[model samples]
Target: MHTAKILIAYDGSDNARRAVSYTAAMVGSGGNRLVDVAAIERPADRDLFADDAAWKAECARRIEAMRTSLNEARAMLVAAGVPEAAVTTRFVESCRSPLREAQECSIGTSIALEILRLAEEGGYDTVVVGRRGVSKQEEFLFGSVSTKIIHAAKGLAVWVVA
Candidate 1:
């Protein structure tokens, strides 16, 4: 069998962690297997953060959070059986508005487009992400990213870890 190239969408949420852990188990410690963990941040509108300084601070905080998420996902993969050398990490940021929210089958799941872009560009065969990355209230209001990803990743395999 060919080695699978997997990309994990990590956000430091418990569900995201579970996604990494699950992928790590599925891929095992094969030398040929390659795992990529990515943390994405869509900068919030400046108007939402009050002042320019506050907006900049928010961006910095989000970047730091993304870095932490990538590190955590990499560590999880290493612990779960994947070789440390086979794991790579990435951080991506985009303006939150341009990406169209998936209104067809999902709610507030606009991030799937970016995930799709990364998966295709990175040559990954599989994309893993959590079922829901936010709190109960947020998820209730915003829906799930997993649903959108499933719809968007036409030919690629997508695993939605609970």
Candidate 2:
């Protein structure tokens, strides 16, 4: 098999940390071609009357948070001895629905699907998501993002790291 392009969905959770560690180990050994880290930004609260300026500020803040998380993940990857050039980072906004957006961004929901539409578009071969998310309820209820990705990613391989 060709070196797989690994896409790790990072959200700063312990599960996500494990996913990163696994990716580093798997790819660092020259077993994979490339590894990309993505942090999906959940949609902002939509209040029709919300102040535009405040909303913009909030958006910037969220992006900064995502950047911080990505940086942290990158640091971990480096500590794991993965070359910086071997790893890349991406950030996708969930827009109105993070789970739905992530699904839409990848392959459509289906069994015969040959490729996640979004992953193909983004040139990712595999998608890695955490079994749980950053939410407390996610520990109880199924993680919304991972659940959606598992069901909706169709043709692409999905790895759920816990």
Candidate 3:
């Protein structure tokens, strides 16, 4: 059997938690499956902070928050019978764009681009995410990450759990 590499985008939201659960159910306890739960954190804009020290501190805090969210996702997968050794967690900064001018813009591209980047770079077979996240306002303003991932991902399976 071929080993399946699954990437799950988690944000500690209700729908994201559901996506993790759905992935666990689909992947089961098979040793042939590898699961990665990742959260994409937007970088703190330099202009928003008053000083360099404060900017660094805010960045640290955001990463720590993502770590906490990743931990929760890991626990969920483990509880659903995925082996602890078969699952991993990570958090990446989502401040990149293929276009040089868009690299600094982090509003609309929350977790979608980073998830796609990781999926391709890691050679993941499937990507899973929530249909919607915690911020309806942000979705309305910036478009949905899951929607972006769905439209952008190619030659890979994507699951958007509700």
Report lDDT (CA) for all predictions: 0.77, 0.66, 0.80
* Candidate with the greatest lDDT versus the true structure: 3
The TM-score obtained by model 2 is: 0.70
Q: Candidate 2: lDDT of 35?
A: 77
Per-residue CA lDDT of candidate 2, range 1-162, in tens?
766677787767778888888777766645546777876564456484267677666766776787888988887887777777778887665445323434433222221132244467667778876665447776356436666667777556787776
TM-score of each: 0.81, 0.70, 0.78
Supply the global lDDT for candidate 1. 0.77
Candidate 3 Cα deviation (angstroms), residue 122: 1.5
Best by TM-score: 1
How displaced is residue 142 in candidate 2, in Å?
8.2
Candidate 2 Cα outliers beyond 4 Å, as residue runs: 48-50, 93-116, 133-143
lDDT of 3 by residue, 29-116 (tens): 8669999998766667778878878877877777677778888889988988999999999765545312213233334344688788
Instruction: List candidate 1 segments past 4 Å from native.
Output: 95-109, 133-141
